[model samples]
Target: MGKSGQFIKRWKSLSYDGKVIFLKSAVCLLLIKTGLTLLPFLQFRRLFHRITETSTVKEVSPQQIELTVWAVDTAANLLPFELLCLPRALAAKYLLRKVPSLTLEIGIEVNPAKHFEAHAWVENNGTVIMGKWPESVSYHRLWAWK
Candidate 1:
């Protein structure tokens, strides 16, 4: 069939728990997007911190959570609006409550011609989980949140 039909079939194939996780990720994305639009940067950070702190910790494997986040992000990124790194990293962090080994890292790069740019990514056990770049060496790590 067509792409929409394929997507519907794939979504229908997921277990109930998987569907719940996907919905949670979607909510996280919406919250982050709205916070960025309606609140100051610090205020958005506070909101994110509060949500993450209050979220229930599920007993799931780090790899499983990472995969779920990846799937959600992939689907979300298909939208017309830019989803960016921050929302993706935040969603991954929110889903990986029990797996504290994974951390969210922000990095920056400066180019004389192109100006400055920043990126956020998730990592577990030193391996990049999301937002990996082929030229990772070009960016200087700014800070990380665990």
Candidate 2:
């Protein structure tokens, strides 16, 4: 079958909960992508903080965390525009807002070309749930939010 058929088949194969998570992730990613384009960094940070604050703290299972990561990554892949690591990480944070142990970290590194690069990732209980890079260890963590 063609790509569209494959996509439809994949969509049909997902469980109801999986489908919900995927849809939520897609919308969250799209919003974050657009927000990043229109808002200043500080203003967006405040908006994100307000959004996350609405969720009551609750203990989250590892399976739930994994599902959140999978949904965000899959949705990011299917999106028409490319999503950078920050937006993906932010989307994961939004999905995992109820987890008190959730942490969002920003890191920086100097590339071989002497260009400074930044990366963002979400971690739960010290384990990275999104934005894991091949040279993840090389990036110096600049900030972390819990």
> Of the candidates shown, which would achieve the greatest TM-score relative to the real structure?
2
Q: Model 1: residues >4 Å from true position, as ranges?
A: 1-6, 54-59, 110-113
Residue-by-residue lDDT tens digits, candidate 1, 54-130: 43445677557765775658556655577888878877887775675678899887555666889898887788888
Query: Which residue runs of candidate 2 sit more than 4 Å off their true CA positions?
Result: 1-10, 110-113, 135-137
Worst 10 residues of 2 by lDDT: 131-140
Superposed by TM-score, candidate 2 places the C-alpha of residue 137 at a distance from the truth, in angstroms, of: 5.0
Q: Look at candidate 1 and give me any clashing residue pairs.
A: none
Global Cα lDDT for candidate 2: 0.87
The estimated TM-scores of all candidates read 0.81, 0.87
RMSD of each: 2.8, 2.4
Question: In angstroms, how far off is 85's CA in candidate 2?
Answer: 0.3
lDDT of 2 by residue, 54-82 (tens): 54778877877887898898789889999
